[model samples]
Target chain A: MTDISRDVDQQKYNQALEKFVSSVNGNTAFDGDFQGNIKPYQINQRMLALNVLRNNFPTVEKILGESVFTSLAQVYGKYYPSTWWDVNIFGDQFAEFLASQINSAKADAYNWALIAEIAQLEYAFIDRYYYPGHDSTPEVLIEFSHFDYEAQQLIKENHPNLVITYNCLDRFQSTANGEKFHSSHWSVDSSQKSKLKIFSASVFRQNFQVVSAFSCSTANL
Target chain B: MSSIDSFAGKQCSLGVEYMGAGLGLRFPHIYEILSQKPKINWLEIHICNFINGGLNQQLLYELSEHYPLSFHGVSLNLGGPEPIDVAYLQRLKQLTNELQPKLVSEHACFTSFDGRSYHDLLPVPYTQKSVEHFCRRIEQVQETIGRPILIENLSRYVQYSENEFSEAEFLSQLCQRTGCGLLLDLTNAYVNDKNLGISIDAFIDALPHQFIKEIHLAGFSTHDEWLIDTHSAEIPQEIWNLLELYLDRYHNVSVLIERDNNIPSFQELYNECCHAQSILDKYPS
Candidate 1:
């Protein structure tokens, strides 16, 4: 084909693909988007993004049931569609997304700020998990007996990759951890901060494992 | 199944056996694959999973020691309009240099567009312009990696309203232009056959036999009333039938039983691989 015809053909493909991308992404609809059932394609993208969310934000998935988690993932994905090549890093903005949703009354399923904080902790967990710490597991483990007040600062200085995330340790645990806290107890709204004395929740690796081990500041206090 | 004998020595691939059946290495089976080390032909790796230094990366290195690994990537987005992602390519090049995998493959679909990345594989249009565009990208990839890579066909929900070439014709031209091989996915062809009226038989028959280097057999699930390529459940009878059809024409090519989600015990997936191996045993090698 000649240059002129090729250029026209290229322009046509670019236009078609741009509309297809926007439509599948739920941004805008054009006449006859692509050809066939695009709903499944859209659904599949959400499912793929959910797998990434489940990996990065396990605490969020656990606190929210499977159905709720799936819905949250789809909605979160539409707002902040991933721009990272690695799906493992897809949910970097999710903790903030959850906080935004709850603050805006878009999601009132859980009234407490703990859910969002757990998401914050989970994000840190994934970051530390992906951090190029060591090819092999580190020989020494972090001991809890070392620090009283200045531990967070000291640990940050020592391990630059270490992440100390979130406060209000107990409420997040009560909702997310093994023993189910009563639903009535899960009403610690962020607005009522002084009513409940929130404890600090710092995540650290007990061993070299990627899964984060949680600790509270009550003992430190 | 002509040998890549010319390309193998310098690359350290050294004539991949194309053992009738292989398994996609997923995280669930890592420990079992490490400890139990079940009998299998070869293993395919998701290139993105091992890029950053993580437990999965460590595990992949360990697994590479045991089996001949193939790097199959979803994030390259070669079919998309974005200029080649230099950082991603560099990481892939580093990983390829480190692992010395038997084969490296990416999809013929777009996973990113308009400055945003997508996790799922989206379809590429079958126009001559698209063919030329992807060829330039594929050639760039080959020049960067110093080896030809196979492009896998995607199981898509929609087809473009207008096409200058059929899927088969497009793939054939793509390989001829860029010197890449085809990762013929029978499961995807089955999905397209059932969801759209595209024929797997015609797709296979039309392709030049030499271009097919690997075959993928994956499970599809019906979600939201449409047959989606979930790779999360059991492979249906129709996909198995398609595999038999594929094996009849082709021999000594790598075949992988791909299961990403709803992963079964390693033994169960291995059993499915063995089932594929049994069918291969029936045919002449």
Candidate 2:
């Protein structure tokens, strides 16, 4: 082909590819002027989205059950699309997506607030696992007994990364029902009636492992 | 002469040192590899995994101290319509400068378009226009990094109708135009042979042999009528035979045994490395 014709052909090829990508991103349907079949491409996009969600949100998947979770994830993937090069960040907006879904869900069927809280907790854990700041600084060994009360208060105020938030009431109920924290098998129980509460705890990383303090209310912080 | 005999006993002209048989480094095996210290010649790592400074960075630094490492990237998106990402390239350049790996490589495919990343290696159409586009981006990458990058052919399921050149011919011309090297992936060639009905031997022979700097051996899974490059299984006998053929032809090219999913025990992976080493041992390099 001549140089001009080759350029024209390549332009057409790029346009078709962009169209196909748009289809995968759920912006439009797969209708492009290309010679090859689009089914395989579609399959690849869905499989990738499913795999990434499966990796990042095992807890959410278990809570919603695999079938429902996967279907919801497929729809969420289409609307959100992947904006990051790293698959680690692909499901960053999943908690928000789940919250939106819960808002529209049947009120009498499931505990949407509890589900949304679980999603937020799982997303935070994943984010912290990959967060560079977690490993960037050396762990400070603060001796509370040696410090004055004012000094301790100053330290608590300055060390913001040490604080972790959780829904204490849900956690207590879930544990009473024989569920372990950070366990993927945990499911919400509708039988127990309790008020929702928030708590903050100081978390520490020693020897490359995370340890959380006993739960405390926001008033303590 | 038989196809294998045609290029037998020939020395590779790529000038890269023979690093012998190596394996891709994975997170699960990091501690075991460091503690046990397997008897492998070198290692290859996905550069993106170690781009951020953290536990992986610390582990990679220790691994580099023990073994000669090579960086293989998945997100260069060299064949995309947009220009190569400057910030990504700068990160890569910084990494290469710090690590000084023996060789650096990326796919001859695009992974992103229009500011959205698919996070998968999307195939480029085999056309003169594509060749020009890919070569221009590759040249830019090489200039930014201060080294020639090896481009690996992708395992493709679909072929565009406007392709003006065969994949092999396009790769050969790409190397000639951009001064890059080829990272010949035997499993991808084998998968394409099954799905696209292209002759593996012909495809291998058509490539510019002198430009082949490294070889990758991996396994693929079968999904219905298509052979997907899942990299989750053991090396098939057919792919092993193809690697042997390539080694017989080009004696100095480095070989990597890659397993990303369904990762086996370190001993099992080492045995595969030993298998490749046994072939390399026959060539008297």
Candidate 3:
């Protein structure tokens, strides 16, 4: 068997760094097995991953309640660190991370799922923002066809996150053909680029009314 | 001009082009920005959120036809040693092609390392090694987008003992080396001054100010005896004073007022923008 902790080289230094991170969250204890000084780069990477999780999942951070969340995120980051240039992709496993914590099973109705969904929505927004060729013209609308089955068949291709109800379908049927249906309209100014990707969903705010949620997606029409 | 454009214009009248004095557009204020139709110069939206299948697509067509917009990003992480996000850059390139924004900017700091991202804008150590890293990244980004990238100075609470040069020096070198423009955040300079114990003027003097494509002014907070760039409060008097000094020093500079948190009423922001306009007017070329 290859001795993983005995080598006094870059590989050993990397293992030591991983061990130090694991030790932060009680996963592994440091044994002073490696040689040389601690690297600033290692310290920075550990801190940055922890910070990304902390920022992206505010609710999880709240549930873990600061100290515990910080500690766990630090640990989780070491093991399943982000692989993307954008930090927004880091909190993908936050829901799973939260589930592993004590008293995690007793979260509120819109707790983990809500946060996960919201984070997903946030990520979708980011993805859409970065998506190219998002044409701003109304000519890109999906055709609603009563005669041709193939036209409305495209509904299956719509984003799964897009909230669709029998009522919405009925409303759409009621609207005249060739007329754009805007249940809710949010504007993006000229200086700004619009990249919403998720299909509209219903969100109930303080008003206790179901509201449409816009998606961020690829700009390519 | 439309009521919206005029309102946005009144916010930041550079007396030339209309990038407008704008606030970081958040989800909460979408209604107010649209309904009130306030005469603000421009609105800055996050590039990450704006292009995705959210409000950007839902409203962009209508909004773009009406008002001017700009992009402010936090995820570029230009100072990192890791490979840049090509997809993100591609999307940004597409968004810019569509939006044709007057200005698009990112921080001078690195937000990620080793693939994992730190969402906050973390400062880059001002050293020759870091400078080279940033310049190469900036060149890549600008090349990909086919536009000059405006790099903003970050407000850091902690200073690394290993940093060999001042922030301004590093920025000047980066611009000179990469041909990228500078987005001088005056408030960040103030924060660095207090926390890192550097003179504000010395920080200003070190940089080649003529290459500044834009300026960002925002408010900050103090925590644990350290000056933090929270972007959540009103611009402090001292920072505003510093801004005035900067405007006086650099004529014909495009300045922006950034309010990312604890955002006040639109009228209040417009009022503050008018103050910025008045300052710029006082130092007109």
Q: Which has the better lDDT: candidate 2, or candidate 3? A: 2
Instruction: Decide which is better by TM-score, 1 or 2.
Output: 1
Candidate 1 residue lDDT tens string, B196-242: 88887888899866767889998988865667788988777888887
Off by over 4 Å in 2: A1-10, A19-38, A106-108, A129-221, B1-15
Please provide TM-scores, in order, for all candidate models, with all chains considered together: 0.79, 0.78, 0.65
Off by more than 4 A, model 3: A1-91, A94-210, A213-221, B1-20
| Per-model lDDT | 0.72, 0.71, 0.59
Angstrom error at residue B96, model 3? 1.2
Greater DockQ among 1 and 2 belongs to 1
Interface RMSD of 3: 8.5
Encode model 2's per-residue lDDT on B1-285: one tens digit a residue: 543332331223234677889988886777788877877799999988777654456567778878889999998888889877787789789879988999999998888888778888887678767888888898899889988889998888767656778899999877777778899999999888888887888999899887788999998888777888889999989888887777767788789999988988888888998998888888867
Model 2 chain B worst lDDT run, 10 consecutive residues: B5-14
Superposed by TM-score, candidate 3 places the C-alpha of residue A197 at a distance from the truth, in angstroms, of 22
Model 3's CAPRI class? incorrect
| Selected candidate, larger lDDT, 1 vs 3 | 1
Error of 1 at A217 (Å): 8.2
List candidate 1 segments past 4 Å from native: A1-7, A27-33, A64-71, A106-113, A131-221, B1-16, B223-225
lDDT of 1 by residue, A49-109 (tens): 7877887766567667788888888888877888878778688888677777765655566
Q: List the residue pairs that clash in candidate 1.
A: none
